[model samples]
Each structure stands twice: as C-alpha cells, then as structure tokens.
Target: MFKFLGYLFLMGYILIPASMAQNHVFVEAESFDNKGGWVIDQQSFAVMQSSYLMAHGMGEPVSDASTTVQFPKAGTYQMWVRTKDWAPYPKGPGQFQMSIDGKPLPTVYGASGNDEWKWYKGERITVKQLQVKLAIQDLTGFNGRCDAILFTESTDFTPPNTLDELTAFRKKQLKLSDQPMEAGHFDLVVVGGGIAGTTAAISGSRLGLKVALIQNRPVLGGNNSSEVRVHLMGDIDKNHYPKLGRIVRELDNGDPGNGNPNAKEYGDARKIAIVKAEKNISLFLNTHVYRLEKQQDIITAVIGRDIATNQEIRFTGSFFSDCTGDGTLGYLAGADFRMGRESQAETGESLASTKADDFTLGTSNLWASTPRDSVSTFPRLPWALQFSDEYHIDEPQSDWQWETGFGNYNTITQAEQIRDHNLRAIYGNWSYLKNNKAEKYAKHKLAWVAYIGGKRESRRILGDHILNQMDVQEGKFYKDGTVTATWTIDLHFPDKKNSQYFEGQEFFAGTKHIRVAPYTIPYRCLYSRNIQNLFMAGRNISTTHVAFGSTRVMRTCGMMGEVVGMAAYVAKKHNTTPRGVYQDYLSDLLVLVKDEPTPQP
Candidate 1:
C-alpha cells in the first residue's frame, strides 16, 4: 500500500499511487505540480463540490499546467475529464486540450456544448509507462476550467454526476475521514478573513481570548485584496466608541483605488503580517467553513474544508462570529436571516422599496487594462455578450460600476453565472474597442481581471435589533449604540442605459446617495437573535436593506467587528452570552469599546 504524501507547496502535488484497491485514479486539476498560469477557482465550490483550475488569461492562452501520475500497470485506460462549456450559446470560447506525456489528446474539452459540468469521455490510451506526465493546454484565454481527471482500466466505470453522490465519491476517493480532525478549541472563532473578520480576531485575541481566524481565500481583505481591488470606504475612529477602530487604522495603509492594476497597492503582505503578529490568534487560510455543530440554537463547532486538499477540520469554540459576507456560517448554524430589500412599511424606512422584492445590490467582477509599448490585437468573440458602439463601456478600467445581478440573479447560488456574465461583458467591450475603435486602444491590453466576484449583499443574519435607514438619517442614537456608521446610504441599482440594452441582465450599475449624519448602530445589531451565541460583522449584520447601504462598507464593518470582539471579551469574562453582554454587562463592554488599547503591528 502506497500512502499519499501530504501536499508539497513548491510542487503543488499530493502524490499517491494508483495501485490502491479502488483501481481507478482521480486527479484534481487544482493539484497540478506546476500550475503555470492557471488559477485556483473556489468561488463555486459549494455548488460544484470541488475547487477547479481555470485559465483566466483574458483572451490569451496561459502556460500549461503539468503533473506526474503513477499507473498501477501498463495497459489501456479509459479517461474522463470533468469540465463544461462556459459559453455554449454558439460555441465555447474557453476551449482547452489535455496532453499525456507530450502528445495532445484528440478531444478538445470545454467546447462540448454542455452548460452543466459533466464527464467528457476522451480517447482511450495505452499506458506505456508506470509514470507519465499529465498536462492541460489552453487554446483560448477566456475561462476554460477543469475540475478533475479520471483514469480507470474498467471501461464501464463512470464518475458520479449528482452533487451529493459526487461529494461522497470524492470523500471516499480522497480517503477523508467521516469524522473531521480536530483543529483545537478556541474561546472565539471568527470565520472569514475580510477586514471585519481580521479585526474581530485581533480584537478578541488582544482582549485575552484564544481566537481562530478562518479565511477561504489565500489572502485576507476580501474585496480589498488584490484579487478584487476595492478600496476601503467609510470613516473610522470618529464615533462614540472612538477606540473601536484602532485595529482598522493600524491595518489601513492607504486606498489602493478600486480595480487598480498594480497588486502592490492592495497590501496583501501587510495584512498577513498584522494577523500573524497576534500570538493568541491562529490563522487558517484557504479553509472554508461549511458545516456547523450546534447544541440547541448555539453553534459549538464549525467544520472547515481545505480548498486545495479537501481535508476537513473541526474547530470547537465557545463563541462564533459570522463575517463570511454571505452569512454562510450563520446559515449553516440555522440562524434567522434576511435577504434582499424589505418593504418600506416593514422597517418604516423611507429609502426602502414601497413593496418588497428581491432587488438587492449587485456583485462586481472588476477588470483593468494597461497600455503596452506595442500594438495589441484581440479576437472578436461571437459567443460573448454582443456589444455595439452605443452599448459598450468606453472606459479602460472597471470600478465598482462594472456590476451585475441587481434584481435578476441569486447572489449566492448564481454567483458563478453572475461572474461569467461580467466576463462576457468585459471581453465583449474590450473586443469592440480593439477591433472597431482600434486607433483609440491600439496599444491597450487587458492587464487584470478579478475572477472572484466582489459581492455587495447576501443573507443578513437577524439580530436583537435590526437597524433601519431612519435610525441613521434621523440621527437617533440608542443607549447601546456602539459602532458608528458614517458613509452615505449608497444603494446601487442597474444603470438605466445598460439596462435598456441588456434588459433584465444589466452589466453596468448606478447608485443614489442618501446623505446622513454619522450615526451609531446599537450593540443588538451585532449578534444573532435566535442563534444565541452567534455574532456577526460585515455586510451580513442585522439591518434593513436601506440601513445596510451605509453600514456595508469595510471601515464601518470593521468597527462592528471590533465591537463584537469587545462584547465577546465581556461575555467570556462574565460567562454570559452576546446579548447578555448588552443586557447585564453593557458598562463593561462600553469601557473596552471606548478605551481599548490600540492594536500594534
């Protein structure tokens, strides 16, 4: 029996022999030894069951990703590849090929006209050697993706197609234990590595709580990370609890400008350094928390799966924080939550919709282009979103405005589709500029494009008090008000001009700003109402859609995290719950919120 070696970071491999009892070999595309220019895409992992490798070279073919595979014996094998035609309307532009050793496969994958992911059969090949190299060669730089490859001597064996079956199959194949390995107990567990989650973990750690900070992505900051490139917004350190944003200030180097082409401006390393400096905090990167272990209504542990290896780890904690932006953790724990807009009558907020509908703020997949020394050429894609001179965006760079999914799509389940729609818009617009308006953009080339969608709104975990627009606009201060929100009620809508062309699937966005005086959000808005021990920060906080417009910004959300952390400290000290901190220990919490020592890096 040949045991699988743990993942090798330098080689990006988890070597295992194919001679095992299963007889079939499964290779995850994301586990390629040399990824070359391919990227790991985990955005649709929950829906798709696995993180795949994508070639996001912006219409240019990326370098091939290669790995070594060991076969049990030299024999003919049937191969199947899990993939899909991303744009299968006419023909997929994201076409790619596979190579065994050095010879390319006859079947061109990703253009099979299959919209849903399925196993596409490839030509059976004779394995001449026990060890051979496998490679993925991209033909189009558009977003060709591969989930996993299967090789089996039994021709009748087929991989599972359904989500539940596929998940179980993968677990069995990977030898993942049904019982997750322990990730240690913590006083507080903060899920998500965004600004709010980072601050929450740091604040809790500094306040004498052992903390675990879990982030799904490789880097922190979420939208502010180089991957999404959104600048920090909202004012900090000017609230009733002035010391609440101390950790935020220490982490905010400066604005990198939304969708900046230069990655250095985002300060990914700086954020990592700050989180690592906290001794009481344990940081888990590329770990996505999906399952919750609960007793009654309170979450006792969270199960996180490593995005790369599919290894599951259980984190037990006395207190839990839902900073996943999408309220993923809260949802798993059966926390009461809200989504989309609320009716004006429901919240008594003037900015809310007259009648409730699912018209929430859209998600953005920002892109940027830079001028090159030499002229650049782009292929006209018939399958991409068709854009005419009157319909296309003329800008060289996309900011927060290059958004989609305002009222049409579910921001969570349809996230992958939303991102693809944005990609089609971007590529189509760029194609028009390069082919039709050649003189203007002759030297311009696509520099950067975010594959990870910068989401605005999702499930808002219900809390003790749901803040509304009137609370901010009327400057009504509650006695329990803690985090101060200072940004305008900037609600985004589908741009009318773009909507006229694309109808229900608008790719551009516009916003109306309802200016408001700086207002403090009540402490009751920070913790789950039904799920007793649950706390929330970031865009998932309890608020009407109108109030969320002001509180969703990074700086404002970070302050909410700081407040949650302080409240957690008081709760831990007194052996009380999050609401208990507000009810019985409000004074103790306020002292910490108002005079907590500034975080040092």
Candidate 2:
C-alpha cells in the first residue's frame, strides 16, 4: 500500500515508503541525521554513482554517525553495506563497523580486500522494532567510507555491481524521474563556488544581472573554504585595473596559512553571508553540474544533481561560466580543452617539456598536528605506505608541498586515488615519526587532515587567446587587458629526494619560481574560443601549462571572474555574446572597469 506525495524539490528526495517493496530498505550514508565526524565525499560520484560518508580521523577513531530508519516489518532481514578497502594490498587501514540500536554488527566493513566499491553482506538479524536507530562506528580512523546500506528479506538478492546497472537500480528503487525540474532562468549562471565563481556571481549581481551561483560543495571558496584550507594568493588590485579586486577583498578572511588546524580562520560563514546578501544572486550549494544542454554552439541550460539526494535540477540561463577547476561544465558541453603540459615546440615556452605528456601539477591533501600536553600514542600502520628515516618527511604539519598525482595519474579520473595516495603517505609518515622519533613528537596529535584535495592544475578550457609564459615574462599587454596577474611563473615538479624513494608516485613537490612583472591577462582568455555564450575562470582558464603557473592562484582567478562578470553584464545589456562584448563593446567594458564601484554586501 503505497500512497504518493507531491515531489519535494528542495529536499531532493521523493517522499516514498521508507521500506521499498515491503521487503527491502535503502538508506544513503550521506543522508544520515547526525554525521558526527564523518565527511561527505562526492569527488568520485561521477564514477562511483553516489556520494558517501567518510571517517577521516587521521589516526584516532572519530565520533559515530547515527540515524533512524523505519523498517516495513519487524522480521529477519539481511543487511548489505556498499564500501571499499582503500588500501587492500596487505590490509585496509580504513576499517569501520555498523551497529543497529547500539548493537554491533558481526562483520567489519571497509577491509573486504576489494579495491573497488562493492556490497559487503552482513549477518541476517531479526529487527525488534519498525523504527530503530542506526550508527556507523569507526575502527581505525584511517579514512573508512560507506556509500549506502541496504536491508532486504530476499536471500538471493544482491545489489548491482556495475556502474550502469547500479545507476539504473538506484533510480528504480528511489523512484527518480528522468527529467530534471527547472531551477529559475537567469542572466548569468556560474557553475563554481570558488573564489572566482563567488566573485563572478557578486560582480554580475552588482552590475544589474540575475545570477545563479551553483557550487558542488556545501561551502563557497573551493580551496579557501574550511574544507580544503588553502589561503588566498596573488596580489589584488595591483597595477592595470585598479578597481578589479574589490569583491575578492570582501571575501578574503586573512591568510590562514595552508592547512591551518583552526577552521574559523578560513572564513566559510563570511563568504556565505556576503553571497546571501546579494539580492540578485541565487546560491545553490551542494549541487554538482554533470550535464548541460547545448543548442548548436550556444549553451542554453545545465543539469545539476544534488550531491546528497540525487535530485537533478535544470538551470536555464542566457550565458554560462565554467569556473569548475577541472573544467567539468565546459567538457560536458563539448568545449575544447587541454589536460597536461604542452611541449616546448607547441607552446614555444622554455619551461615546457621536450614532448607532450600527461605531467600536470599535483593535488594536495594537507594535514596538521598539534602538540598535546600529555604524551599521545599512535598505532603502527603496516598497511599504510611504509616510511624509513631516510625516506620519511619529518615535518610537524603538511603544507602545499605535500602533493600527489603528477606524471603518473590523471587529476580528474584518478582523483580519489590521488587523495587516497596522499592519505597513505600522511598516515605512514605520521606513524613513522610517532614510533621512531617519539621523544620529539611524543605529545603531538593530529589536529586536522583535509579530506577534500586541493587541486592545482587539471583541464584548461581553450579560449580565444591562450595566455603564454612569454606574455607574462615580457610584459606583453593587450588593449583589452582586464585582470592583472602578478604571481611569479611558479611551476612544481616531483622532489628529487622524494622521487628517489617513491619514484613515479612521488608525494613531495619542488617548485622553481621564475620572476615576472605584473602582466594583464587579455579579455580574450576569459571565454571559450568555439563555445558561444560560454565564459571560463580559475585554473581552467585558457593558458599554456607555463602560464597557468602564474594565473592559477586564487586572487588572479578571482580577478578573471570579475572581468567575466563585467563582460556578462555588458553582453546582456547589448544582447550580444561574450565575444561580441570584446569586439563591439570593448570601450563600454573598459569604462565599467575604470569606474568600478565598491561592492556592497
């Protein structure tokens, strides 16, 4: 007896019987009522099919995530948990247990010896009540994860293992619709909530445009948010465009050095407050844009799925901006993009490699520890990457240098692997220091470890003019030069000492900074070359690998967003495309840039 209720759009999940089919019940880990220390990880949702809950305690066990579920009937039911042993070589460090009504389950999860996500069957237990409390208890606190839990009565029932099969199964079970509900049309729809996207939305709103700022994560400021903890970099309002960086300054909550243990220093609330204050801006957090509708060369709308509930929302707009660091939106719309470094011959930059390769700047999962008054104990991790005195990084806390996924890994496809690799390195090194050098770090305890990896370089969306290294070094200025990038052309490679030990999967990074004068990026580099109605900012902006080193910083990226927003306003005012703004309304844009007003909250 199923009674249908109207679809709840905001909640993202359909109102269905908690017990589907009277014999089976599906519960998403991310939808837990009290998540405790567990974090929602959606980085691999595109591949894995759903966002899961992760216990990232560094070493110590974190608090349990608890929730209540309603069973169809109080009878014998078999339980299944979808999870993976992140490191299954010897044994997984990410170990955890599930409990019902405070009673522990017989089987331990996350150490099933399977490297991929699969369903782990649990003992059949008789349910004593229809509504019962459930909890996920962490064992090792070394990044254990749980995707979803299923309770079924059928003995032969097995959850789908394949991605396609699992996707269909989830839709069928959850009763999700094929069509997406419309999220109001806007003048400009920004697809990222980083410093660049946040600034772009604010800029467009201030310039009299209805803007929709959609961020995949719950918080704004991608890396600078409390989740990642990277400080804002690059000089703001330096030389060319004096009034460009005012919006960025509003969101800057002092430089909380990379991977700071104090979360408040990163200023998540301040950014949220400022964005919410904008009357013309509609902020959609925790919504990831996976697909888009492109008519001919113009993008008309984007389809985003809720990270937690899987509800898809369609955002229609006149113009769109690809601020996703990985160029996700642009790639979905079939825009031209480059992933790795360009060859010396291709870019004519001396810093470019001899030949084109997959070598790109790595991602960082920074961690920090504090010295406790009392001596602390850490478990020896045999399953983690072993580290010796000669090979170990003897540091109190990890910074931007603690990075992975350079030449050997794909930053987008293998992102979870990259993050897991960093976790292994972090835990392994910490274990070594705690065991071997106990006298020095006897009282040290891990305070914070980032679950969300801070990425440097990924897909660079191709635009009208690709910014190059020589352009920055030789002070090549454009008439349409809007945002001035002042950071040095700093490029990172695997550390020689670390490479000797870890080889291809080197975790430590070494960078050489080539000094450059303040160079203004051309307006042509802000929008896609072929994709009409498309604008891009952040690390994905059109740039050679060498030039990206200079423009990839947050402040510089934010300035690019400011320019994009201004251009969007002009384009909307004249009913022209992004390119048409530069070609036809160049003077109009320059006038706005020269006389930019102070942004109000």
- Top-lDDT candidate index: 2
Candidate 2 lDDT, 238-346, residue by residue in tens: 8587888988899999888999999999999999999999988888888889888989999999988778767778889999999999999889889999989899999
TM-score list, all predictions:
0.96, 0.95
Error of 2 at 30 (Å): 0.8
Model 1 segments more than 4 A misplaced: 1-13, 16-21, 598-601
lDDT of 1 at 485: 87
- Looking at model 2, which ten-residue stretch has the lowest summed lDDT? 1-10
Q: Give one digit per residue, the lDDT tens place, for model 1 in 1-601.
A: 0012122322223553122336777787887767889998888876986788999999889999888888778999889899999888767887899999989998999987777999988878899898989999999889999998888888898889999998887777667677986778999999999999999999998878889999999999998899898999999857877767888997786987899999999999999999889988888888888888999998899998777667677899999999999999989988899898899888888778999998878899998999999998999889888989777788899888999888799898888899999998999889998999888899999999999999999999999999987898998899899888899999998889988999997989999888888899999999999988999999999999999999999999988888888888889999999999988999998888878855433
Clashes of 2: 0
